[model samples]
Target: MKRALVIGASQSLGSHLATRLASNGWQVVGTGRRPASEVPGSEGFAYERLDLSDPEEAHRFLEGAGSDAYDLVVHNAVTYGAIPGKPPALDELEAMFRVNALVPYRLLHGVLAAQPTDRFCSCVVVNSDSIYHATKQSAPYAATKAALRVLTTSLADTFRSAQVSVATLLLGPLPDPRKLADFQRVAERHDVPVEDVKRAFLRKANPFYVIDDLIGFDACYRSVEYLAGLGPAGNGMVCRLDGGSAGSLI
Candidate 1:
């Protein structure tokens, strides 16, 4: 009766992971803006419709999502808020950091505080490194994720004794021929359908394409999963996925 909690389960990747977890025998608890309208098929699971952007709601949901404990916490929720529609007074960049970095940080801490056991809880988070160093436009979103990676590693180092684990899913590029031909190489390397990989991109249509690279996602998921399985001690680990052209973590 393992229970898993997933944040931002409305997206394709999040929804897919929810279904995948349910099929693998874990009872799933998820959150979204419109659980009733966008709720993923139960597949023998449950969901709550709430905006994780609301810190209080996010904290409350994480505090008691499952049977007083979560075997795994897959944090797939994020926000770029980098769109050009807002005014400077609105502090869009700050807001991006709040959701992309701050909220997730507080949620993790809250989760730890509420746990009955002193042990570290297993966690998986979604992020983008290519956005940080790879490109310049996504500075706000990229910096937050980059900082989060460091924090996750630090947690891994600080909490290994308790057996809690946290890992980041760092993504690369998608298989959009218009962008680059190397997408197919990456898709084949990870064994994920081309479409499944497309969700990583940020575009206005289809899977969208704001994300700079999707090719390295499979490798990212695998390496993070491996580190998480190793418990909190796996934190300081600098695992990376090079996609098709690279050999190993260098």
Candidate 2:
């Protein structure tokens, strides 16, 4: 069976992708900051505790994983620091940068180094659509994502000769319960109506509002699978999975 490694598989999109990959007969190893006991729906795959915020922990994990090669690797871990409107401290920004971009670079470097001479590897980096549009509140988060995109492109170029392909999936907002709850909390804190906050979020995510519903996990899975299946031909590709929101303005 082909082996796949999913970084940040504790919850939300990461968990869904891990489960789906296992169901498809792939031997999957998933990493998350949460303990295995705390993570739900982790029956089919192996879970490892990986906290990307600490440089020492991240370096240790990379060092240990340097010899283990995976046919498919997905970097899905991210941290959005300080919630919007609040300026993040220097340490917070550093942590966010590490989790959002730097850790991924190290992880991919180790994985690609261990790839077998004759084996092919497909690597997917999950980014956000916020990179295209600017938001004062989310400017810091968007900067990290933009940095990730540049790193992914460079990786694609550097590893092309080694039979390793890298692609970036620029995803839009999804209906994650956790994020919805966060919005509610923010609205309450700011003394604004929850519905107004939701409406504002939707409008910002998709100015055209062409699609009534947010993008689902199934769609994201399909996009990732499709890109992986493309092999080396999809190298350096940046795919937008934002339900046509980014291009609607064109």
Candidate 3:
């Protein structure tokens, strides 16, 4: 069986991907900051608690036994630093960068180091289409993703001789129900209508909002599966799964 490790598999997209991969016969191991019992879809695969914000914890997990026994590794964990109307605090920005960019770099470096040079492994970093455009609300978040993209490219080049393939999957806004619920809670906290909060959230989240532009979990799974199947051929590929919402200027 093909083994895969999915980081941050507690979130909506990550949960869906992990479940799908398990259903498709992959021996999947998923990591999340939350405990397995607290995660909704925890039964689909083996679960590990990994706090990406803590460097020492992440380092220990990476160096643990059987860390390099995977054909695919997907870095799906991310932290948003958008404070709306103003930039995030310096400390918050640093935290966001650590989770979004540095964690993946460390995770991949540790995994690759343990793998045999002759073995093949595929790594996918989930990024955002926000890196392709400018926006005040999510500027800090976008900056971190941009840094991740560049880091993926550098890793791909550096690990070419080891038969390790790295790809960045740039996704647009996804119609995750959890986001709407979170927005509703925010509205309640501020004594605003849910619809109004929803509108504002969507406006900020989907800057290039064309009808039917939101990418689905299935589409993302297929993209990742295809990239993983490519082995060495898909190294350094930046696959944009945004349904063309990030339009070309050229």
Candidate 4:
């Protein structure tokens, strides 16, 4: 069986992706902040605890996972928050950037530097269109993604000689129940009506939204599987999956 490493496989898209890959015959190893039992559908895969904010923990986790054991690595871990007034504190900024931007770089460097001559590896970084079109509330999140996009492109060039393919998938907002619940919680915390938050989301997301622009879990799984199947052909490719809106290769 082909070995695959999936970062941030505890919940949401990551959880779904891990489960799907396992069902399809990939020997999957997943990482998450929560315990293995807390993560749904983790029976057939290995789960490691990783808290990106804790440098020591993060380092040890990656070190143990190694760099070249897996044929594919999918980075889906993320930290999200929106500040209302002034920019986030230095510590907050650093942590978010470390998780979203730096971690992916580390994974790439490790994989490309150690891959065996006879094997090929593919690295996929889950990105957001917010990197291109940012809203007021998405500054920190968008900045991290924008930085990651450039890092991925640069690394793709650097690793081509090693027969390692690196790609960025710019994904649009998916209609997830947990995400909607988080939005509701945010609205409650700010003392704003839920409808207000919903409206803001609709307006900010309109430019990139399709008529029915909700991305489902299956679509995400298919996209990653397709990219992984590309083997040596998709080196340095950047693709966008914005549901019904627009899909392209950049």
The numbered model that scores best in TM-score is 2
Judge candidate 1 at residue 140 and give its lDDT.
Answer: 55
Winner on lDDT (2 vs 3): 2
Candidate 1 per-residue lDDT over residues 87-168, each given as its tens digit: 3235776776777777777777666455557545687776654443534455556677777776666655555555466666
- For model 4, state the Cα shift of residue 74 in Å: 0.3
TM per candidate: 0.70, 0.89, 0.87, 0.85
Q: Is candidate 1 or candidate 2 better by TM-score?
A: 2
Clash count, candidate 1: 14
| Model 2 residue 89 CA deviation in Å | 1.5
Task: Compose the digit string of candidate 4's lDDT tens values, residues 151-194.
Answer: 98888888888867888877888767776897799899999987
Sliding window of 10 residues with minimal summed lDDT for model 4: 241-250
lDDT of 4: 0.79
Top of the candidates by lDDT: 2
Worst 10 residues of 3 by lDDT: 205-214
Mark the 10 consecutive residues where model 2 has the least summed lDDT: 205-214
Error of 4 at 236 (Å): 1.5
Root-mean-square deviation of Cα positions for candidate 1 versus the true structure, in angstroms:
7.5
State the lDDT of candidate 3 residue by residue for 1-250, as single tens digits: 9888899898789999899999999988899898898876779889999888899888889877337588888989988765667778888899999999988897877887677666688999998988877577877888999999898899999887777899988988776776767877899999998777766765666655553434789999999999998989889998888745577553
Q: How well is each residue in 98-186 modelled by candidate 2, as lDDT tens digits?
A: 88998888778777877897888899999988887767788889999999999999899989888799999888887677878978998
RMSD to true structure for each model, in Å? 7.5, 3.0, 3.4, 4.0
Cα shift from native, residue 79, model 1 (Å): 1.0
